[model samples]
Target: MENFDEQFSITKTVEFIQKNKSTRVILQLPPKLLQFSSKIEKHLKKALKNDKISFFILAGASTRHCCVDTVSSARVFGDLIVHYGHSCLSSTAQIPILNIFIPTKISIQNIISAFETEFSTQKTKQMILFYSTEVENSISGLYLQLNKTFPNLKRTLLNLPKNEKEKVKKFEQKQEQEQEQEQEQEQEQEQEKEQEQEKEQEKEKAKEEEKEQEKEKEKEKEKEKEKEKENLKIFGRVLPITDITQLSKNQLIWLGSSTNPTLFSLALTFGAENFLVLDPEKEYLEFEKMERMQPMRRILMKRYALIEKAKKSENIGIVVGTTNPKKDLQIVKYLQLLIKNSKKKSQVISMGVVKSLKLGNFVHDLDLFVVIGCNESLILDQSDYYRPVLVPDELDLALNHDREWDGTINLNFYPNHDMIANLEKKLKQSFDLILIEQQNQKQIENLIISRSETRSFKGLETRLGENKVTKIEEGLSGRASQYQDEIDLN
Candidate 1:
């Protein structure tokens, strides 16, 4: 339904394939975008007509649609991949990818009017701008324009690849260097003679500069580590932002689809009061009503209730909702260890996508389920579930008696050092208590045998309680429907 030529740069994709000299290219699209595959393929083939080049369109991803399908590309022997639709901008280790962000048109004037109407009263409050990745191409235009009117406004930017203009400049520079290669060679001799003359004079200065550079490099390494600690990666998108911790205090202006799940995740992470949704498609700003945020707050309440329910549970089912085992395996094992230390039984189950019906089969076996997956998959609607479901954070709160709830929800499954330390202490205590109980049972058994020594003179009759023999009777042998008790009168 959407125009491929306007929204996506098919020329850029063609240039990328040509640059890479890729014989086999993979075009990975989400399910919604599959219908446009023929049109996309036709355009690509018309633009690039190389006999050796072959194109393959992967209908859907192996895992979540937001994630890049690297495994599929490898299966198809693809050298380059062009991903369509919305992406989390997650870094992939296997293959190089070009993400095509779908852009939607929005009136800058309308947005400014909405902003003024909402924030005209409070001019001092700083706001953070967040938009879905689909509208990323428009965000630069929106951000630059919005900052002209509101000087204090700040927006988080993704670390994107080089633009077409930069690429063109680099290509031109390479061509210019090739053209001037003979001239540069002629000047190289002159430059070498000048370099030799200055080398002796600058030798001592160069050593001192190198030492200072080493010291500065060390300082930079420390700074980078600190930066790494500050950066937060949620739902696979890495946000190198500082204001995220202060989100509860600051106002958030969300620009994207109203039905985006990330919007709800953000609201649940921070309070809903600070959120203002500006839907470009709907062409309105939703802030004053606050009715839309009610469902997210309700989700928070539901998750909290599930935590309480999880605390009382005896058998916990740790559901692995991610296909990537390396990322979630440690989390699953850690949860199991924590539940075990709490004196509860835990079982690890793997499912690509967790469903109510699949989990319902274990309704009789499991008391509650703790899902270990990405941030997007962790928040599930459990209204249809017979048993309650929880994320790793809730599971941690439920199992750990030493820790208290901080009234904040974190969807990231990575546990910190403090939690690990607390779990170790609890484990030691549980083991000590278990050993004490075992010793007490052994002592009670010895005491029972000692007490029975003087009162067992009556032999087997004392323990058996004087059994009496009785005659056996024939048992009824008929179907349940024609049982003796239910027979009709004859």
Candidate 2:
């Protein structure tokens, strides 16, 4: 609630409604900030007391700004959507979106001390102030004092341009989602039949299967709910930028931590030599830049190696990672078209979250799989599947032979018109060469599989259907402190 700017938000929302002649609006806040919806609505109603403006709160919580509530806005027929807390994505929505940036708890004194402590000894002039939602509170003070001392200090504000699309893809995606849900229900019903014991108790057996399927569905829903939770604990603290961008800017000092969506976007988008750590919590400011992001840099190498393997691939599977109605379907379509042009067989699979076990079933049919989703969530840990799972960016690099290695992966492929258009053109061009390559590669597929090690899951013969006892390293002592206050001797 500390980050909620009630006065400012209410005023702005009222003004916007009046100017646009809007009667209804939907409020979309991050899960962390959702509790303040009632208070915000109250203030809004009081302000527009005379007018009959209806305000609806979006029940579906979002993790990142990329998860725009297109469904709510469209379904409600809302004139505008007031998105709060997170920084904006470079996405054009069907409805007008008002992004309200609320400042974190970091004070001006803390920010000033961070700057002074970092540059007390040395003369560091070329420094950039990178900030997100925490702008209104800390920025004015930093600017007031710093500008007087230094002449040219640059600030990179991560604000998105307002570009509303004429056609909204929400309705179309919703239809596809409904059809998929129906298909899933049918498949689950079929699986229940195999799991049942006898036909004598058919109705009872069907009920049991329904209960089992419901339990599985409940688990999946819980997993998705956990995924949407924001790490609100990471906010307000300043953190170092680990990326090495090609931007000519000298030093980058980001104001927000990794929790802020803009921090990652700017770090990946901009090119700087070294990022100075000027966190408010630290007593001494880190003047020296941290070590280069070697792990991330290695992703480039992985991309190159994967591309080589994909070149000799005979079949491809397109895996859509997200079940959300607002996910991009164009990327899947384009990948299918690309593989088709190469004369390779391709299949599209909608897997909510890519699991190695689920994908292993298609290992024989598919030689390679391309995952379409968020860059962070696209690739899974260890990647234990038989076929290589690559994101859209990785797949794009692997398939297209005519593009320079930029060494940057866009998390959300938006607002990059040039890249998207060129990729389409390259994929649609004459495919005689690619088709020939695939034909030749088909001969080597069997040889590659024969050399690969087959993976297996085995049950312990001694303890079948038994719960194995877990080793407690600390035992009672560790748990005592955890529940000391709750336990009473009486």
Candidate 3:
């Protein structure tokens, strides 16, 4: 509530809503900011008088507070969502969102002074400056000051897309995609007509030429694919540095709250050695003298152990953490298929937030759970879950019987054609070995029949002898807050 007007642009939001003519708006606030929800809603309502707009303050988000709760908004038929607090700036949401990032105050001079004090004697060639979204406004100023003070050190700022620009670009990209699809349809029709006309005249020569051209194109495509695979293996949302292969050599300077989870994820992604944190609001250095290496090492060791355990898992559960209808859903389907082909039973379950309590119910059924979520959500504590939870890359490595572990961990849950093909190849190799083994055994059919007979099917006997059934009854309708069945005492 402090500096509410300066921190949150109520006027701009109102004007934008009026311009867009959004009737239903969902205001999503984090747990910490929930106290101010009523105040914010009242101000917005007062400003938008006679606009006939409804504001819904959504609490208890299913996903991380930083990520937009598009699923909840969609449930209420909200046309627009105004998200408060820190944000991951994920562009995968299905609805329009306005992110109002919390601003943190910090003195640029203090950060410069801290940097000078820490590395006064240590000679560092390159440094990568990472900042949280809360302190993004001050990052540029700090970068400028640091550049002026330390001219010898090569500095790089982790550049993410601007909030407004990212949304606009997403809209433009969608429009462009639609236009391209229409153009492709027209081109296909024209090409079909031309092909019909030419089919009778020079059929033999045209067929031969087309075959040769197709072969050349395939060869070129294969070459390009190989090159791309060799050059780019890095995926995930946390792309701090350009050449991530050389990340070990550079010093990492983080500008934001010390408690932010992103810092931990970055530390896990890269090594935590030579990492510094500057709390912008407090204007002081954290972890300056403390030991971060040991904690990071423990995390890596636990994750490595989990990966090893995941290989022996029989019943795997693919946990979808985000509401992304495209990428996350595709990953869930692909993972299920991959596990099935690998001769392991797998199940897909969707959740807004994955917790130990929620997963405890499935502990008896699943041996391990593979989490497909945002970069931050991928890093779960070892003690949190009863069973081992592995990321997509970790699961991929576990299922891969031949690949050797080189102490590299990837948090990429995005859909990649190469990853799928590689896993499929490994599964096929295993299947071939199984086939050879089956050929050597004469009682394969009998063994399969015995295993099938042991399975239980109680559904066929659960029905009662009587054919008459009860009449269908109406259920609760509308939103949970105001169900149709609730009686009005007033």
Best candidate according to lDDT: 1
lDDT of 3 by residue, 1-490 (tens): 4378657768767865665567899999999999989998888888889558999988889788877888888889998888888776554565557767778777777777888877778644477666787776566777777877665455433323333444554566567668966865776687877666554455666568769977986997799676545443322134344455766776777677767777766666565665777676663454342135246667677788898898789999989888777878678766876787768999888877988999899999999999887767765556877898888878877876666666656664465777667767777888899898888675888888787788896347555776777799888898887887788676
Which candidate comes out best when scored by TM-score? 1
Candidate 2 clashes between residue pairs 3 or more apart in a chain or in different chains? 245-271, 246-271, 247-271
State each model's CA lDDT, in order.
0.72, 0.60, 0.72
- State each candidate's clash count: 0, 3, 0
lDDT of 1 by residue, 1-490 (tens): 2366767678878887666556787888888888888888888888898878888998856656766666777788887778888775543434456788767777767777887787787755777777788777777777887787677787876644333334444466567657756654666667867666565555666578768967986897799688767875565444536656666656777888767867666666666666788887764554543336456656667777888998899999998766555667668767877998878999888775577888988989899998876666655666788988788888888777767876657775586567666777878888899899999999999999888886757465554756786799888777876876675876
Cα distance off (Å), candidate 2, residue 190:
79
Candidate 3 wrongly placed segments (more than 4 Å)? 121-124, 152-241, 283-294, 379-384, 406-408, 413-415, 429-490
User: What does candidate 2's lDDT look like per residue over 346-366, in tens digits?
Assistant: 888876546789899999899
RMSD of each: 11.3, 28.4, 21.6
Span of ten consecutive residues with least summed lDDT in model 1? 159-168
TM-score of each: 0.73, 0.56, 0.69
Candidate 3: clashing pairs of residues: none
lDDT score, candidate 2: 0.60
